[model samples]
Target: MIKSIGTDLVKLERIKEIGIEKFAERILSPKESVVFKTITNELRKLTFLAGRFAAKEALFKCFKKGDLTANYKDFEILNDENGAPYIESKYTKELISHITITHTEEFAIAFIVLEYAEYK
Candidate 1:
C-alpha cells in the first residue's frame, strides 16, 4: 500500500540563477551530471535541478526521517534506459513505493510514493 505521497513544483529561472554545474555536482549523481551537461540554457538546467530537488523532498516525505538531516546527495535522480528520471537512494532503498518526475521549460515537478518496507 502507498504509505506516503508528495509533489513539488519549481520555477526554471530560479534554479538557473544558482549555476547548473554547481547545483548538479552537489545534488545530481554522476549520470545525472552527464545529462545536465547537454543543457545549453541556464533555465533548463534549473528546471532539471528543481525537478530533482522536488523528488528528493518527496522521498523524505515518504519515510520517517524524524530529526535526521538529509543531504541532497543522499538521493540521486537517475535516468532509466528510456531516459526517464527516477530516484536512487542507496541508504533507504527498500521503503519506496514509486516515484515520478516531470519538467517543462518553465517548471519542474516530482512525485514520490512510499510503502512500508524495510530499509537496509
Candidate 2:
C-alpha cells in the first residue's frame, strides 16, 4: 500500500547563489558531501546540489506528520552502479521509498513515493 507522495522543485540559480560548499555542508550527508566535492563542472555542481536539496525536501514532506525527527544529515542519497538514486536511512527501515530527480538548466525537481507492505 502507498503511504505518501512528496514533490519539490528548486531553482538552480538559487542554489548557486547559496554557494556550493556552504550549502553542501549544511544539507548534504557526509557521503553526499563527498560526491558534491568530486564534481568538476560549476553548473553540474549547482544542479547536483539543487537536486539533492529538492530530494531531501520531498522526503521530509513524506513523513513530516509522523513522530520521526529528520535532518538533512540523517538521510543520504546514493546511486547504484547504473546511476539509479536511492535513499539510505536508518529512519526508513519499515517504509519503502522511491525517488526520482531531474534537472533542467534553470530548475531541479524531485518526487518521492513512500509505501509500506501489508503483512498478514
Candidate with best lDDT: 2
Model 2 lDDT per residue over 22-89, tens place = 88889998899888889999888888889999998998888876566678889898898999999998
Q: Which ten residues in a row have the lowest lDDT in candidate 1?
A: 89-98
The per-residue C-alpha lDDT of model 1 at residue 98 equals: 68
Per-model CA lDDT versus the true structure: 0.73, 0.87
lDDT tens digits, residues 1-120, model 1?
Answer: 567787777776766677667767777777777778899976666777888888877776666574477677777777779977667766456575467888877777888777767541
Clashing pairs in 1: none
| Native-referenced Cα lDDT, model 1 | 0.73
Q: Which stretches of candidate 1 lie over 4 Å from their true place?
A: 38-44, 64-67, 117-120
Q: What is candidate 1's CA lDDT for residue 97?
A: 49
Estimate candidate 2's alpha-carbon lDDT, on a 0 to 1 scale: 0.87
Please give the lDDT score at residue 105 for candidate 2. Answer: 92
Q: Model 2: residues >4 Å from true position, as ranges?
A: 118-120
